[model samples]
Target chain A: MLRYTEDHEWLRAEGEEVVVGITAHAAEQLGDVVFIELPEVGREVTKGEEIVVIESVKAASEITAPLAGTITAVNDAVEADPGSVNSDAAAAWFFRIKPTEPDLTGFMDEAAYQAMIG
Target chain B: MADTPGGLRRTPLHDLHLARGARMVPFAGWEMPVQYPMGVLGEHNHTRAKAGLFDVSHMGQIVLRPAVEWPSGHARPAAHEEVNDLKLRLETLVAADVLGIPQGRQRYGLFTTPEGGVLDDLMIADKGDHLLLVVNAANVEADLAHLRTLEGTDVVLLDARSLMALQGPEAEAVLERLVPGVAAMRFMDVAEFDWDGARLWVSRSGYTGEDGFEISIPDHRAVEFAEALLGDEAVALIGLGARDSLRLEAGMPLYGNDMDAGTTPGSAGLGWSIPKVRRTGGARAGGFPGAERILAELAEGAKATRRGLRPEGRAPIREGVPLYEAETGGEPIGTVRSGGFGPTVGGPIATATLPAHLPEGATVWAELRGKRIPATIVPLPFIKPSYKR
Candidate 1:
């Protein structure tokens, strides 16, 4: 299940682990991503709190945490090549987290994600 | 996504920019190419190493005609022109008495308000029969209106023309092959030559602080000329992003970022624009707006001036970031004007304005992510200039 936030970050839960990254629309608006600050492993994150800092050539924007979770894993691949977000926003998840509350309901699905982006 | 910015304009190179995989961004109401796949850092460093061709067509390239025909307004002298009898008529807008810049030379100048504040910074080139003026894309309409008033006197202004810049170290060698005589013209000089049947006015000047030329080619042949330059192994197509970084590294100020209606040329560290003749009284020519304040600023010194800042970290410090004194941790002083990660310098750099009293090498803080990033005030052109001069 995928859920979206007003800030354009998306969360997808696979069992207890939830993947987090920005949406396609967010990547488009950011132009090109040069550097990204990934959440550290085992860091506790609260919903709507500052999470990541993505720097493009023109500007830098902070990606806020969309849900309360503990970061379990970070996508080292995307950090090696931040352009993955521009190329494939959905597939290029920034990190995976084990939610403090595993029950995530009323979240955005693929259709809702499309609607939000469109 | 939207086509128009309340009815602004684009350039002939718009399509080319898109075709070259550029990220089109809105700038001054024009859909301009900001950067390409190589990215701003790569493009900037490439230009410094080899040659970078910039499609600065979005900039307004105008030709100002003379009110009279025969003498042709005395060929609208270059910006470097001294304050002398014959050269005196050159500058009608600027309070400084120009009339010194010889034909085919160009200089960076400003349109100051009556209060000594800068209205715009423009490049004035004397094309002999007319003046070739390049103004910021955002200030095109206003600059045109201001120049139109002088049309009836001795100056008649021309509208937009196609201008492209082939900059970097290999620029001269590449351009020299196309226009044979251009190589002879010294830096800051211009030459009239023919390139593939096109009459071009090429100037040995560039904003990147590199030895390069800005070729004023006809609009129709702009794409072809661009292609010809891109074909060179030494040249790569660069976009506005690279242009910004290159200028930042060169310590050149962007009009809207480094200068605006609120800043003065003196305050912007453009003292060279104010000819010594204007200062020493070769002529008491003081009429244009803000003569008193501008002259006084020239006499005394600017209260605040723009300087370069280099943060101690790799993270970029953006504009609007506050500058705090690291020593006292007192109230915020200046703000960042332009900042980016300089690829060549291997660190993040920025241009900012601080109190003139602040000592050079003073450590300051730039608020980033609620943390104060330590930065040092240093001389500009973070990288050594590569100009052939």
Candidate 2:
């Protein structure tokens, strides 16, 4: 199951962990992604806390956590090639987080996320 | 975002910009385009390679006329005495030697405050009968107020005029199609011409380090002129985003960002604009505002001087980033005033204020988002200017 946050982050449940990345809408708005600073693995994050910093040629943006969790792993590939986020935002997962709260409340579904962006 | 105080003013080409899919943003009380569909990097590179058209009507254009009436009324021959008197009177407000500029020529000048800080940087064109001054949009009001304080000069704001800049190596060729004799005009030369029954005040000068022309036309004919220029295959409509990056790469300092009212001409590395005629030893010396402090600073170097910085990595370091000594491991010694990813350089570059004692090629570290990135101070401009003599 996939869930979206108002801040344009997406999370997908992968058994015991969840994958996180920014939405295509957010990536398109950010223009070209030149650099990204991802949180280190094992860092404790609360809901709506800033975890990633993405920079384009023009400006910078911060991505917040959608749920309380501990960062399990990060995508080294995206850090190596930040442009991949603009190429395919959905597939370019930023990190894997093990949710502290199993019940992911306050997240929107696919339709809700689409409507929110619109 | 909510509307700012006083609302945003649209330029004469606002409709055309929207039609061309420009991303409009608030800039200095104007709704200006930040970038077009081509994006900042593409637009920047295109201007450097070919020609780029920019709508800079947001800038303030004013004409200063002498209060004195012509002696022979209708048939005046050159009126050299009146022009000379007017130039001398105008020189009281600026640091540049305005009286020395010949007819049909323009020079870069600065309006310095009483404390030696720069109020605004402007271009003054000696138009024989009157002087045409082009100032930054943000400083227009203050500049006008300052100019109004003069006793014998009549300052008239050219609000109905639209200013456009066509810049690049091929700018001359592209502009020659519309104005036949524009190619002959040297850098900083201003001329009045007729284009399709409309009058134009064109100058062979621009903010970009490239050879270009700044065309001032009636507001009603702006869209027509812009469309005609865009009709050329070599000319593309560029936005403020590319303009900023291009000027930064050219080592041009912005008024409010790079050098504000707190920064003096000596510290901003713009002492060249203060000609020798205005110095202490010259004939007409120490007459302009802050002349004493400015001349002193010129002889004895300022505490901080503006320098070009080249960061080591690809991650761009933006403005307000602190600068630290390379090996001292102490507090910040300076701050980045203007910085961005230079599309032409293909990496991050900046202009910062560092100790005047720091020589070129000195190593410094810029603190971006908490990490100290090593950068080297180099001689400006990062790219050589291609102005036609």
Candidate 3:
């Protein structure tokens, strides 16, 4: 399942952790994702809060966390090659975090993500 | 490309951009198509290898008449040409000779306040009888207001046009076929001609370092002109995305990013723009903002200056990031101005300001999120300038 924000961030869950990245529409709009600053592994982030900064050729964007959690693992590859997000946003997760309070029942699913993008 | 400004603004070719499947975004209060379906990389490469048609109508395109005074004796709104030309003699705008700027030639100029502080930087094209000015979209209203106050001669300001940019290696060939005789115009020259039954002022100039032209046409005819240009096989509609990357590769500075009111021409590495005449004029140099400080800086030399930065790896060091000394990583020496992944350069590049004495190979630090990233000082225009002689 994938949940998206009106601002174009996307969130998904993997077991106890949630994976987050910008949606394809957002990545495309950002042009080239040249640099991405991921949050530290132990940083506590709240839902709908800015935790990452993604810079493109034209401007810098703050990527908001779709859910509250403690960051666990960051995709160093995406930081090393931010263009991966441009090529495949869904697969180029910025980080994986375990929610401080997990309850996936309230989040939007894949259909909602598609509708939000549309 | 479909991002309409809702209540902001829609360029003359707004519909055309959306129709072509452009990914539009709000920029400087206007709905601008930043790129088409071809994406940023494709559009960037296309403009480098071929011709890229850019709908730059969001930029304010104004025409100037010589200045005129009312019966009350108060000067009318300054025509763009008159203010620049008249002020040039007085050195009121900047320490540059506007009148000497050849007809059809494009020159980068700045508006300096009495204190010698920068008001704005713009591209001014002298068109013999009149002047054509292209100002930043965000500052159009303010620029117009400022120009009004400086109109001492017979002149009028007209905002009845939109502009487009056709840039890249094959740009000249495509433009030549569309508008003959443009081929003879040297880089920085301006010429008037017809395109699709409408008259236009074409300048052999653009932000990108390429053989290109910036065409000014009636607002109503912009869509038609855009369509006609796009009809060519070699022309692809590029948006702001590619425009940014292209300029980055060329090492050109964006007004608000690499420069602002606080930064002086000397510190920004724009001393070349200040003519030699102004330098020798000494006491006669017209007073602009921070005149005492800027002129002093010019005479004494800038403390710190803008330079290009190359990060060691693919990770980019962005703006607002601080730079450190090479040997000991002592005090913060400078800050990143414009940093990004330049698709044309195939690497990460940045424009930063640092101590003027810092050697080319000097190392620096860019605070990316909290981690200090290592960066090296390098010469600008990450790629070579390819302007037509």
Candidate 4:
């Protein structure tokens, strides 16, 4: 199952962990991504904390944690090639977090995400 | 987003920009296009390779002439004697050598405050009949009021015209197709041309550091003119975002960001625009505002000077980020004035006002998102300017 946040982040459940990345709508709005800095793998992050710093050609944006979790792993591929996120935002997961709360009711589903973007 | 403080003013090409899928943003109280669907990076790279059309109509355009009376029901160009009178009067407010500029030419200049700081930066063009001044959009009212303070000069704002810049190497070929004789012009040369019976003022200059022309067209015919230019395969409508990157890559200083009322000409690295005639030990010197401090700084040196910086990583150290000499706690050495990714240079670049005493190749640490990022001081013009000289 997939979950979306109003801030344009997406979460996917994979076994005991959940992967987080930005939506296609967010990537399109960010223009061309040139550089990115991902949080460390062992960093403990709280909800609404800025974890990822993304720089496009014209401006900069920060991606925040949607829920309290410990960063299990960060995507090295996206950091190596920042343009990959623009190419396929859905597949380019930013990080994998072990959430303290397993409940996913707070996040918007696919239809809700589409309606929010609209 | 909602337009604040009443509403935002739109240029003549507002609807045209919407048709081209532009993202409009508020800039200097105007609803200007920040980017197109192609994105700022693409537009920036495209301009470096080919041609890009820009709408700069929000900038202020004004004409200054000698306050002379003419015969009833008729007006005439400023005579040779009156021309000298007009030039000398203008020298009181600006830093450039107004009396030295030849007719049909222009020079980048600055308006200085009475306290030795820069008030605004502008371009002064010699138009024979009158001197033409192009200033920043935010300073329109202030510039008009300042120019009106001149005792023997008449200030008139040219609000009915639209300003467009056709930039890059392919700009000549694209523009020469619609208007002839622009090929003969060189950098900073100003000329008047007629387009379809309408008076077109043409200047062989632009902020992009490319060989281009800034053409002033009437509002009624601006859309037709823009469409005609866009019809060419090489011409694409560029927005302010790419314009910022291009100008920064060219090492150009933005008025509000890099320099302001609190920043002096010496600290702003604008000594090139201050001619010798206005300096000490020269003929006709020391009459303009802030002449004492400006001349002293020119003779000696300013405490602070503008310097180019290359950030450690690809991430840009944006404007207003504090800079420190040490990695940890210490007073900020400087603040980034303007900075972003340099698409042409393939890295991040910035410009800042640093201590003049700092040695060459000194490294200053910029605090980015609470992390210390080291940036090296370097020379300017990260990319060489390609002006047609």
Among the numbered candidates, top lDDT falls to 4
lDDT of 1 by residue, B234-353 (tens): 988888887887888889988878877788777777766777666645464456677677777877888888988989856788778888887445788888988987777767899998
Instruction: Give the chain B TM-score for each candidate.
Output: 0.89, 0.96, 0.90, 0.97
TM-score of every prediction relative to native: 0.85, 0.93, 0.83, 0.97
**lDDT of model 1 at position B296:** 78
Give the poorly placed runs of model 2, Cα more than 4 Å off: A102-105, B1-6, B70-78, B326-329
Top candidate when judged by TM-score against the true structure: 4
Whichever of 3 and 4 has more TM-score, that candidate is 4
Go through the candidates in order and give each one's C-alpha lDDT.
0.76, 0.89, 0.78, 0.90
- Tens-place lDDT per residue, model 4, B1-389, is 12336588888899999999999988888999999988888899889999999999999999998877767734556797798788888889998898888999999999998898888899999998799999999999988888998997879998789999999999999988889988889999999987788678999999887889999999889999999999999999999999999999999999999998889899998988888888898887868789899889988988888899999888899899999998899999889999999999888999999998887689999998888999999888888999999
Per-residue lDDT tens digits for candidate 2, residues B1-389, read 12335698888898899999999998988999988988777889899999999999999999987776567654333367777888887889899999999999999999998998999999999998889999999999999999999886788998789999999998999999998899999999999988998899999998789999999999989899999899899999999989998999999999987887789899998999988778878888868788889889997878898999999877777889999996447989999989988878877889998999998988999887678889999999988899999
Candidate 2, A7-108: lDDT as tens digits: 888989888788999999998788778788899999999987988989887798899887788999999999988889988999999999999876655689
- DockQ of predictions, in order shown: 0.38, 0.61, 0.47, 0.82
Q: Is the docking of candidate 4 incorrect, acceptable, medium or high quality?
A: high
Q: Which is superior by lDDT, 1 or 3?
A: 3
Candidate 1 Cα deviation (angstroms), residue B226: 1.8
lDDT of 1 at B359: 79
